[model samples]
Target: MHSPTKRHALPKSNVPAVQPTPATTTDLTGFTPADSSLRGLVGGTPVLRVSQPFTSPDRGFWAKLEGFNPGGIKDRPGLHMVERARARGDLLPGAPIVESTSGTLGLGLALAGMVHGHPVTLVTDPGLEPSMTRLLTAYGATVDMVPAPHPTGGWQQARRDRVTELLARQPGAWCPDQYGNPDNVAAYTPLALELAAQLGHIDVLVCSVGTGGHSAGVSRVLRQLYPGMRLVGVDTVGSTIFGQPARTRLMRGLGSSIYPRNVAYEHFSEVHWIAPAESVWACRQLASSHYATGGWSVGAVALVAGWLARTLPRDTRIAAIFPDGPQRYLETVYNDEYCAEHGLLGVRPGPEPELIGRPDEKEVTRWTRCTEIADPLAPTVRTESIEGGRAR
Candidate 1:
């Protein structure tokens, strides 16, 4: 009989142990422990190479693990937007900072609030994970949940309405308005520079589109360095951001119910709409194989990046941004029961995406790709109207 395969174990450390230092008196090796030091920890995240299972053995992509930052990728934008607002006198000192978020940005805003001495109030909907709500409160952010979604715009718009109400009630309050803010798109310049330094060259950059911040920001900066680089945008099946009809979206961190003005539609070479099941399969696969995974956005982007690795020229270098880690998804994406309840378990994405010519082609319901991207809000494009014939 064949011997049972042995499980690999980590090698024991050989370095001699040093005596523990007291927290009050110990000197940090490379880090300075100060209130201001927290903001300093927001960037310089490392990149990881993912191969095999996710991609062919000889082909892979570089993933910028933005989860390494204190509060994930948005920490960069959260701090930058707040800083710029203060500098421009748009936000007064010690003023209340109000904004709407699904979850990820709430954490970032909380961090920004603590760092900048501002009070943060995040408006969200019922879909936000319980862990995130508690964590935001723990971080000293006031959490406000909208009672219901808007008649046409859904939960995102409902949260926005609540933000407006809150802003009106509080004097000297400022909202980040991440969906349309230029600063949000500009905040990822450092991230793009980091990717260029880490990968040397990037042939294709894949990103998930929510507010269209990071994708637009990073690609804009990277294109300046590598003019020939291609940008691939990933969105959920139900997101209206890519011209799909608005529907309930299960996944968060990416996919918007509204057409965010920050989306650089002209920059995209193609866009993919991924379903919840496909994202679940990808997330699980990444966790089991590479031991590095994130929530919906990460999974969707990875699925697209892996396909690109397999189909693109052998010499092509692809970079995917993982917006955040899996710690916040314990109740949903990573939970077996939750997956079963939502019919998101045991379904594998097709090796190749179904192709379409335009973003509005037949309302994509699975892993579908489109090359002809356009701003759905553009006057030339024909988009269905909502709320008594008002164009969304």
Candidate 2:
């Protein structure tokens, strides 16, 4: 493996910038867009044009189809992180890069490794998507499973510990540390620009806030483009996102046990606390009724986007970032029996009621350090259900 010097991406500016489409005065058949540019991946993927008025009403409602990527939305950050590091002379041509991911980042890393001729090692827990494991392996990267769930163990902590172990063993281990790594958010800035070009103008942006990487990174840029842009950050009801006790749930990729420095909550104009059941139901709703397939995070995001669609102005361009594709969740989220076994069954099938749209101001909702769950900074957070009926 090549031993490249450690390099960091530049700090992201909150200033708004719009992404401009390729302006061509003449058409040339058999001409392809320029290669070697990340922006090329931005809008070429499928974007659904919503016809129905948001059950409530946003300025306008649409979803960016990030699942079209070879992996998923996280790939945007995954590729950028590795490439930027290499450009800055941080990653040697064949250096073995290490990272902790739920699954999405691993996909992105694999792509990066193949393109740059590098080796990628992923530190993940057993709680990951079954298909995700296969996808990473198919991409030709090494998948190292962390400690199983213990009496008080967690997958997040376990993965982080593996990263620490790898760093201690490997001479030049570079952990993206998505939680604190600014590049995680910085890599997503282009998404905001793409949406601006796609929607013409955005009045409200709906997305789930986990490590705050996607929301913070994208919202900062979107808010800058449209100063009046209303950014809605969605969190699960039992999530520690707003600095509360961690709640066990089925949704993945959104909400965190600790306050990630990369997430910029200040960029959000509003926040919605959706329950796990709601997210599961939303995922089903998207697939069964809307004819669109999405995973847990996308479903959680759609729950908020659906609500915002019905409440905000009709012309307001509402774009929600849909992370991974549904192919990875066939045995879990896509399984009705699996969902019924989980607490996610509680979310009913009735029409979505008129939500106040305003968040609970009296509620304690601020990003803060987590003690209720394991240390987020630590390499892993072993997962266990309070219901203990079956363990992962």
Candidate 3:
């Protein structure tokens, strides 16, 4: 298990610590910050205690700063999957890797490819941010952008199809189908252990569901340690992950038009769908008060986590996973112009959660839930996920 370096330690004053940077010009001092290996820096991310804006009793809620990982939370799974594949002899030495990702997982795959001596090809749609594109290319991974969305299943399915085409063209290519691969779910064991070490006892686990990888992986391990812990799955309003109708989602990384097979829906005690406006409000509030924030999913998870902290018992310990940093979302979630353009700014947070009783229900526009948990796509559509059993 890879243990991340300790970080996000708070000062006695309760103010966010300011990290010192080297001067513009190098001083004559021989002293240097220690950083031995790129792979060594992968895990051991800090768990930050959120202070302001959350007045709930006890440790209000802890934000696991996955952004501290070089490539964010997905990095854990990405590296784990690659290492496991190589160990199992499924990925031959020096074989090229191919996969479909929006950004976070793409970054993780790029890092994994780099560490494992494999070339990487990431297939994504045009919706991918420019900064992510450059970063992936900088990591020596080839970026393949599908020109358009699929008429039926939308961009995600199109990207998967493109991955198939690319794999056919490049012989001996390995595609880590993050959506269905069980390895994706197994990749976060170390993370769960880290959380156990950090908090000791976690009463509530709030996570944003994307490919349903981290939520399923980490929550499973945590549940073993804290059997009474409640797993709260957060998602965007348009996401179909929680049986909500699939529509155009402004937020990335948490919602999927196509239901991912990796979602351990049964593990989730309850689910919440946050709109873009609500996420914007939460992200900005976190930024101004706590000086910590991320993208849409981060904000969504934080919103739900904060609510859990406030509504639950005073002793309840909630841990929310923040997948990455805010730099990538500067032009979107953090940008005033972009938020205004999308009418996502200054929206009041959360209306109410409506009880859901059936899977075929419609017009779910706000927070919604159902007592039962099952895959909405189970009987209707057969998934095109490659590597059905492996964790990637």
Candidate 4:
């Protein structure tokens, strides 16, 4: 499927006002949304459309310079969620902003907290990137490390429980509750707008589904412009979002055991399951080829995006979202030895993987193994999820 160009230019009546002009408008040409970097942070990112030998040039696959942000693509929603919450009176004065972030959201909350003068508390399990924990801590947010349980209820649920308890203890504590917060969905609206502006038009958006915040919000807005738009929900095989049996996951920030109400599954045209090993390897490949520092989820999305870029028709324009930058994943996915030892180094090296793609290869995968794509209409919550590797 191909992206259709805007038949008419957006008139002055319907355009966002540019960010306040600085005293000296030196080299800044484009705009960076408060949430993401369409235009990168000072000297950090540049918007460029790459032409790769592996994909069709006319189709023009574009990736925003998210790594250019202080964090990455998820920064868009991360900041948006907090700013919106404050504007809506969801946050109270002197109340700590609380959330269970595997990574990027915490950074977003940190940035937003700094801008607005509030304290942020992050509750995460051991599987998260140490760098992310440090990044948030460096931003002055309190980090509470919750130990993951064996077999299930690993740090994910623990963090959730921790947030609940913390809120109870501190009156007026504002738990952003990213997983279910509608603001999470709303945060991506501007991102969708940016995508439309940068890419001209986007036919299919292949993105990693974590809290489903990025996908739900971006896809909804894009749909209005491109009704034929296809939103491919890419979840790690261990995540429970799409009625899958829960399993242990290594990739953080991109998958969840719970189907958050914020994740609007109905907007999707289809779902493509991703494996953690594939994600890690693809991430490394991205660095080598594109010179871009891909995040954990970016590597996963890139793996699938590469597939769509190469195999899809010449007319198809595919836009993919890579939420966080690679800096956070230095110890895990981006490490070569880590990839090799985890059996995620390459495409199995040999046999043709069955249609299921060898879910047994990794002890830690993104989603549960039992999910099938047949029921696209299942209830978002009742469909299935596992707090402890249980997808029910």
Candidate 5:
């Protein structure tokens, strides 16, 4: 992987600064604009204020409900990337869209394929849920399972390798490498705009880091409006995205074994690495206490957001991005036996993580607030293995 230094995207402030129109709602007549078009329904998801289960009303935050989209948060990028490519003539009509994904992006690509009159082939791994596999096929995406992990890089790399093979075999195949694509970062502009209109002003933005699309895209736009707003990044313990060594990670949809090109490390003010058990606990708390919840990344982001809401001043208005709903996690995160089997039920986040240096710095590990941000892969940086949650 190339050092993050090789590619640095300058932040642009030219995106729309419009006030948010009131969120549309469907009346009993059921003729709302959202019902008028499937594409319109992809966005315009609600940003609901959350208070309970974790934080008091005064300390509560708002949640951007991305599950309202048919395919989850990645749907924004899936369509944007495909449309952008088509406009540039990069994606010829009927070209096959092939890319590697875990699940969310697979659904997004499948949706894109459906709307743009093209076939999509998603390369994933054995860890993909049967439910998601069926969902992708239902959306007309051909699923290719990479049979094994790569010798050095694990399932993610293996899946990428398979995508390469498929792309080579298929003519005019376009791979919207979400990890490296600028469009993925650009796709969340409307989301940030929506939050801006809804909140009027935001003090903080909390998001999980997957391909780093939503966080990077949303924060960049929000920062233009609320320059003082803090951007908090959430990640799984084993992810190298924040300079941690690659270890077996239980949670998906956030964090990465590979340092993705899309992560805007400099944009983040601070980052949190949450354990699977901690996320499991948070997820259950949301489900039981508030009847609002999501998968691993959702729980992890909520945990941090809840903490921020509780600790920040009462006047602080925080917004946490919930990637998708809990439907995908029912077999794992929401399952008591699975939680107990994995020793996740009663577990909590690890001891307060050490804050080290600026996110771009190489020496940063565990956690650290630094003055100057540096390359995450700097030679001076040494990565320590972060263990997964032990079975209780």
Candidate 6:
């Protein structure tokens, strides 16, 4: 077992920690004749300073609270992709918009559809939260759940296959191929600008890698402003994005079974793979301490960011992105029964991650970090070894 000294460090914040608050609806702004739609509420999210349990009070990171948006971080891409497609005459007015999403993007698409006057269809897997399913449906989106994982590519590919079939049946329908679409990466420019404006100077950026859109997009813009800024990518343990073999993943909104073309492999200085149990611990810690937390991606990202804060210089300014709020995770991450059933309860992660020289050095099964980054799709001497058995 790993040492727990650093992991159990006490909080240094002067303010007392508060319990997480339940969700509520305080806004009921009328959409009068002179008022515009809700598209204006997509950006301008707040940033929270995360300290204490995650990191020492003197060493904390800034978390971009994307949950403040109408949907989540993907709302920027979902709306931008559709808007760009419409401008290029690719998505005609009143046409159907079909795409594959885990959950967050589905909400964004539903919002985009209502804003732009299009019918949206989302293909997802059975692992999606029931609350998320109901919310997407309530937002006027047709949820198509894939029954099983693909033989090789997993649920992501299965959803893509279903989307292909849906597109074949509907004419003039547009599917925002977020995995390969450049618009998804471009959509995060505004977010990067907001971060630069909010923090003045960012020394390091930490992001969760799912479709690889936000990480690549945000880093691209931020690097232009702060050329020396380092980018750290956080992914789930079973994710194939960083060259590990694809396996069944419990966490969503981060990690991928297949390599997404949007991943800016060269931009990442290092990558960390977090386990589901570790994420659960971090999520609960954030809730009880900071009273502000998110789901899988958020938890995983926070874990990595907290480590960076403890190890890096005190002057280092690290910014981590929290994709969505914890409301959708009530049935899973926050549910005691569900966590116990999954063997995630009472499991605390070590302070430091196991370090590796390369991503394909060995099949990582727990919290691991790699400094040498390479594209799994690119040709290399180790590619043969990875294909032979290392990745399996």
lDDT of each: 0.90, 0.69, 0.82, 0.67, 0.81, 0.91
The candidate with the higher lDDT, 2 or 3, is 3
Question: For candidate 1, lDDT tens digit of each residue in 1-392?
Answer: 99999999988899887989777875678885564578878888999999888777999999999999877999988998999999999999999999999988888999999989999999999999999999999999999999999999999999999999999999999999999999999999999999999999998899999999999999999999998788889999989998899999999989988899999987787889999999989999999998999999999999999999998878989999999999999899999999999999989999999988677669888999877677888856422211122222
Total backbone collisions for each predicted model: 0, 32, 8, 13, 9, 0
How large an RMSD does model 2 have? 18.2
Worst lDDT window (10 residues) for model 3? Answer: 383-392
lDDT of 4 at 134: 75
Clashing residue pairs found in predicted model 1: none
Best by TM-score: 1
Model 4, position 93, has a per-residue lDDT of 58
Best by lDDT: 6
TM-score, cand. 4:
0.77
lDDT of 2 at 108: 83
In Å, residue 4's CA in model 6 sits off its true spot by 72
Error of 2 at 299 (Å): 0.9
Give residue 366's lDDT in candidate 2 (0 to 100).
22
Residue 52 in model 3: shift from native, Å? 3.4
Query: Across residues 54-86, which tens digit of lDDT does each residue of candidate 6 receive?
Result: 887788999999999888899999999999999
Instruction: Give the Cα error of residue 225 in candidate 6, in Å.
Output: 0.4
- lDDT-based ranking, best first? 6, 1, 3, 5, 2, 4
Q: Give the poorly placed runs of model 4, Cα more than 4 Å off.
A: 1-60, 150-152, 346-392
By TM-score, the candidates rank as 1, 6, 3, 5, 4, 2
Evaluated against the true structure, the overall lDDT of model 6 is: 0.91
Per-residue lDDT of 67-180 in model 5, one digit per residue for the tens?
A: 878878999999999999999999999999999999999888888888889999999987787899998998899999988888878889999988899888987899999999
Locate the minimum summed-lDDT window of 10 residues in model 6.
383-392
TM-scores of all candidate predictions against the true structure: 0.89, 0.77, 0.85, 0.77, 0.83, 0.88
